[model samples]
Target: MSLSSFGFLIEEASRNVRRNGLMSAASITTVAVAMAVLGSAVFLLHRVQQFMDAQPRQFEIAAFVTMETSRSKAAQLKAKVQRIPGVYRVSLVPREAALRQMMDEDHKAGTRITDALVGANPLPDRLDVQLSDPKATRRVAAILRDKDKFPAIEHVRDDRETLDKLLATTRLIRNVGMAVALLLFLATAFVIQNTIRLTIFARRREIRVMQLVGASSGFIRMPLVIEGVFCGLAGSIIACGLVLLVIRQVSQFAGRLQTPFAFTMPAAMSPSVIVGLLLAAGAAMGWVSSTLSIRRYLRRV
Candidate 1:
């Protein structure tokens, strides 16, 4: 199309939006609401994934040695485990350190359980191993459990079941979020299509007149398509703004409630890319709705 033709299409679209002010507003609002929900879901899924990713690395696998094991043998066992594949760090937690940790916890809980009261420190000296991969915990544990490999080692303790449950929950949430977002997106599209159809219905007479005067189908369709694009663009912008506001408000509310979870909004992208996506989505939705609406009317016309 020529520049003048494009200009005419834009001008006609603006006029249509203004003439059907209520319908335009409804379409924009629907688009905005739908986009906002989808954006929020996307942001939440990303944040949850980050949290889950951090969990496994933080998990500590404790390799407890036999109570009668010699200090030299314990050090040798620690060195051997440290050399194993996937072992990120290996530190020996002496019996005294284990006792100290328990004492600290008891003190924090306002309990005074002295060593004399407990008869003796029953805590075992352990090799505290941090893995580079949380998913390798089981394999790492198995390696540590080999009596021939680490004869001094008595048991291996890790929160394997809890970590598995957490990962499973994360996957479930991701799947559910995607399913809901897709359903909402389709619903939004349908609503916008119907809204555009209503606008086209109101202009059916004008379209018929143009067609009778030998106006090309392209010429007749261009303005409505542009109008749809405008609606989508406007809706996306409004939705983005609303989502930002909601995130800010939620963060503030969480702080007041002393909630452990904090909202982390996505970083702003380059203005050009951000604008492009929003406008493109809006325009595409608008075009699709307009095309369908016009096609149905054209059959009767």
Candidate 2:
């Protein structure tokens, strides 16, 4: 279309919104509420996935050395474990150090259970192993357990069960969020579609007059479609603002937590990306809803 024609379409679309101010405001508000709910779910799922991905990097494997193993032999085993593929780092924790740590923890908790041991440090020397890929945790633990290859080690332990539970929980959260988000998306679209249809209905007489004056269906539909897009965009901006405010408040609350429950914001859930996603979703919903609504009405006319 030419500049003049495009300007006319924009003007007409603007006029339509102004003429139906109440309905337009209602449409914008409905869209904002729907988008906000859907956006929160999507954002939460993204953060959970990010947390799950980072978990493996923090997981550790522990290999306990037998009481008969000499300090020199334990050091050799640590060096050997470090040389293994996928092993990121290995540090030796002597039984004495372990005993001290355990006692310190017990004291902090107001429990003196270790006081009964009285110079009998039953804690064994262990190798704390970090892995480049946590998927190899079991394999590396098995290697450390092999008696013929590493006779100094008596027990192999890892956070495999904890990791499994964590992964399963995140997966469940992600799947449920996705399902809910999908439903909300459809609901949002439906609301926009119905709202746009109402706007078209209110302007049916004007549309008929335009057609009688030799206006093509496209000429009549373009302005309404643009109006729908405007409404969608307006709603999305509001939704994004609300979502950011909530996220900021949530982050503040999380920071105040004094336990392991405290967490950092996921890098993937950046504000820029969130804003862009909501804007795109809003614009697309408006365009699709208006196009479909106008097309169906034009056919019946």
Candidate 3:
């Protein structure tokens, strides 16, 4: 099509929106409301997944060295643990520091235990092993418990039960998130379908006149298609803004509500990528729903 034809199509689409003011507002508002609910759910899912993937919580392996193990032996063991397939790395905590920590705890408990053990630091050296994957902590801990392989290791300790519980909760969160997302998508689709149907009904005569003027089917359909896409885009933009606004407000209350189970409401995707995805989803939904609605009027056109 020529530039003038394209310009005319744009004008017609804009004119239709202005002429049917109530219908246009209703279409945009419905789409926006649906998108907003869906967008909020999407962000929440991302936050839950991030919490599952965060660090420190996954670092659960603790291996204590025997009293017979020398500092040099413990250092060598640290390097060997790092070479394990699933282990991230291990840090050696000297016995002296460990003793100090124990003493500090004793002091906090209103005890004079440190003075009694001044000549001998009875605490064993510690090797805190962090695994590449939290779920593999049990496997790694078992590997460390082999006395023949790691003679310096007296015992291996890990919060296996707690880690297991946390992982199970994460899985539950993921399953719930997926179910919520499906429901929200269906709701958005339903809203978009009705918006398109109502717009088509309001502009039935305009479509007929364009068809009578010997306009190509594509030409007559272009304006409504454009309108649908614009509506979707506008609704998504509003939805995204609302989602961000909600995040800001929630973050304020989040600070006080979460402790020991604290995690950030980080962006699910980069801002640009998220906006692009939302815009594309909105446009695609608008296009499909509008096409289906317009086909109802195509027989007469």
Candidate 4:
């Protein structure tokens, strides 16, 4: 379209908004509210996924050796375990270290359990193994249990259950997030469509007059479509700002918690890219709603 045509479309869209000011405001407000909720959910899901990805690295495999294992044999076993596929690092914890750890735990628990009172330190030397993939921990544990490899092996411990729980929770959150987002999107579309319907109804005579004057449907519809797009763009901007404010407040609150919370801002995409996506979503909703409302009126006229 020429610049003049574009200018006329803009002028007509502006006139439509001014003529139905209250309905326009309502439409923008509804879009903003729904978009804000959906945006916040998306941001939260992204942050949670990031946090989960970062936490899996902290899971470790504890390979406990039999009490009768010699120090030299334990060292050899530790080296062998480190060579296993997916194993990242292995640190040997001597029996003395284990005793010290147990004593520390006892102190924390307010229980006075001393090595002398226990007659001997029953703690055995073990290897603390870090794995590249937390999912492969079960296999790694099985390998350590091989009698021929390390006969003195006693037990293996890893946060496999905890990791499983976390994964399941994340998946649940993702499913719920998608469902909520879809519902909010449909609600927003309905609200916008109804709002446009009202606006079109108020201008029923004007649309009929344009049709009578040999105005093509495209000429009549272009301006209204532009108006819907403007409403969507305005609403998206408001929604983005509101979402940022809510995220900031949530981050501050999370920071004040006694236990550390892995709260990070959603991944930073280019500002242009984010704005483009929001604008596109808003525009698409607006255009579809406007088209439906206009079609309904045209059929009657």
Candidate 5:
């Protein structure tokens, strides 16, 4: 389209919005709220997936070593475990550290178990093996348990139940996120479409006159489409600002949490990417709703 035509459409679109102040505001608010809800759900799903990713470590294999095992021998043993097909990480859990952890737990429970065992530390040092895939946990465990497979590996232990629970929770989050997002997307489209219909209806007389003068459908509909797009874009911009504010507040509040967390919270999407998505959603809602609403109106004419 020529610059003059573009400018005319923009001017007309802006005038339509200003003329119907309340309806325009309502449409913008509705779109903003729907987008915000969907965006929040997506953000939460990302965080949930991060936790789900860390869950496999909880079901990792514990390979105990003989009391006579040396530091060099343990290092060699860890290196050997890393060479295994599915093993991605093999961390050494020294006996002293293990004892300290146990004692710390006991103290929290109001027990002085460490004092009773002060003369000798009988806890065994171990190697913790993390698998690239939790499904390989049993296979890796069985391999470690083979007869005389690294004599220092006294035993190999893994818990399948923990892995199962973690997997279930992740799946639940994914299903719920998708359902909520779809519902919100549809609601946003409806709000934009309804808003555009009202804008067009108010100009029905002008449209009939244009038709009588041999104006093409595109000539009459372009301005209405622009109005719908403006509403969508405005709502999307406001929604993005709100989402960013909410995320900042949430991050600050989370940082002040009194209870300790075992794992770090996963990083959020980059600011640029998030802003781009919000803008795209807004523009898409505007364009799609305007086109659909105009086509529906044109059919009746």
Candidate 6:
């Protein structure tokens, strides 16, 4: 089509929207509410996943060295553990240092119990291991415990049960969020589709007259598609504005809290990105829903 034809179609779309002012307002408002709810759910789930991903960095495993193993041998074990695939860092704590730490802890608790046993420190030297990934905790712990692999090591300790529980909870939350989002998407599409159908129904006679006058289907469809796109774009702007406002307020509140649970939005969900996503989703939903609505109606006419 020529530039003039495209311009004319856009004008027609605007005119249609103006002519049905009440329905257009209702459609835009409905789309905005639906998209807002869906977008908020997505934003929340993404943040929850980020928080879960961060928990692994603090997880640590302890590998105790036998009393017979010299400090030099424990250093060698540290080197070996450091070479493991998921190992982030390894530090060998000497038996003397471990005993001193225990004594300090006892003293802090208002007791002198551990002071007398200073010379008879029975605490074994241990390697404190930090992991790059929490999921690898079990495998690394198993490797540390292998007698043949490191005979100097007496035993390994890790909180596998806690890690498993954390993973299970994350998966459950993600699955449930996805299911809810899908349902919201279907409902939003239905509303947009029906709204567009109402507009088309009001203009049925005009469409038939154009068809009889030898206007191509493309000519008849272009204006209606443009109408949907406009509505979608308008609705998206409103939804994005509301979501951004809530995000800003929540982020500020989280930052002021003096706790480990304080949350800031992840870098991936920047304001610019959020706006782009909502606008794109709204426009695509509008285009597809409107096209489907009109195609079915045209078949009978």
The candidate that wins on lDDT is 2
Model 4 root-mean-square deviation:
5.5
Candidate 5 clashing pairs, residues 3+ apart or interchain:
none
Q: How would you encode candidate 3's per-residue C-alpha lDDT over 215-274 as one tens digit per residue?
A: 788997888888888788888888878877766665667655633322454445665666
How much does each candidate deviate from the true structure in C-alpha RMSD? Answer: 5.5, 4.2, 4.8, 5.5, 3.8, 6.0
Candidate 6: lDDT over CA atoms? Answer: 0.83
Model 4 Cα shift for residue 177 (angstroms): 1.7
Q: Write the per-residue lDDT of candidate 6 for residues 138-168, one digit (tens) a residue.
A: 8999988889998888888897787677668
Per-residue C-alpha lDDT of model 5 across residues 74-190, encoded as one tens digit per residue: 989999999999887999999999988878867976888788997589988889898888999888898898767787778777866666776797789888898999999999999
For each candidate, give its TM-score against the true structure: 0.72, 0.79, 0.77, 0.73, 0.82, 0.73
Of 1 and 6, the candidate ahead on lDDT is 6
Estimate, for each residue in 1-301, the C-alpha lDDT of model 1 and write its tens digit: 8999889888888988999999889888988998888766765666567767676556768899999998888998889899999889999989998888778766865778764556587877899898998878999999999998888889999878877886799889998998988887787777767766776787788788888898888988888877777888889898778666666665566446532122233343344554465557666876787688667655434
- In candidate 4 the C-alpha lDDT for residue 60 amounts to 77
Please identify which of the two predictions, 2 or 5, would achieve the higher TM-score against the true structure: 5
By lDDT, is 1 or 5 better? 5
Model 6 CA deviation exceeding 4 Å by range: 52-58, 62-74, 83-128, 142-159, 253-266, 299-301
Report model 6's TM-score to 2 decimal places: 0.73
Per-residue lDDT, model 2, residue 83, is 97
Candidate 3: worst-modelled 10 consecutive residues by lDDT: 258-267
Name the regions of candidate 2 deviating beyond 4 angstroms: 65-75, 82-126, 131-136, 146-148, 256-268
